[model samples]
Target: MFAKTQAAAPVEAPKATGPAIVPGVIDFNVPGCKPEYPRASLRNEETGTVVLSVLIGADGSVADVKIDKSSGFRGLDNAVRTQLMSGACKNKPGTVDGKPQQTWTKVQYVWKLD
Candidate 1:
């Protein structure tokens, strides 16, 4: 006699609310300030962009800083961190449903010759 096989339940895919945007990149705003590092010290005279990974708290302030992409110069990297930590950059805290949340943000700093 063949044993009765149980029917499998249908699987449902997870529903997506909408377009998912990275918290950091979604609400990123650059601060206005002159380049702290002199142009003479830059390794490249041409424009350079430094992308940094920064941890922002619910307070909308930089909590941590790490160089995701270096501009090939130590000075430039340090300057970027300095500006961020200085609170010159005003960032809107990330939120899922109108509630502020801590998130890691990727910010780019463009360094150009003056």
Candidate 2:
């Protein structure tokens, strides 16, 4: 006699209970500022995207910037940092449970040749 096999149940994704904004993605109500990229090196002619991790302070300013993912170019990374430090990008402070709190954000910088 052959035994019947039972099907396994599908697992559901965990629901988010926090703010409506997606974690890591920039959602601090910040104004978009145009970023300038440095001239690309001759060796690497291909354009790439740089992912950055930014810490937003309670004062609605960028507290810190960390390069989570590099674009394989130092110049490009520096350019991104400079723009953030210059206060070019404006963002409202993040709130958690009705109180202002620091938040981490991931921003992408795309470098391409004209």
- Candidate number of the best lDDT: 2
Cα displacement (Å) at residue 66, model 2:
0.4
The global Cα lDDT (0 to 1) of model 2 is 0.70
lDDT of 2 at 17: 85
Worst 10 residues of 2 by lDDT: 20-29
TM-score of each: 0.65, 0.63
The positional error of residue 109 in candidate 2, measured at the CA in angstroms, is: 1.5
Error of 1 at 80 (Å): 0.5
What candidate 1 gets wrong by more than 4 Å, as runs, is 1-12, 16-35, 39-47
lDDT of 1 by residue, 1-114 (tens): 999999999999899897343464323345443347656565456456788888877777777889999987777778878877777666777665666777887778887776
Tell me the lDDT of model 1 at 55: 82
Q: Indicate the residue-level lDDT of 86 in model 2.
A: 74
Candidate 2 differs from the real structure by a C-alpha RMSD in angstroms, to one decimal, of 6.1
Residue-wise C-alpha lDDT for candidate 2, range 39-99, written one tens digit per residue: 5553467577788888877676778899999988887777877777777676666666666
Report the Cα lDDT for residue 11, model 2.
90
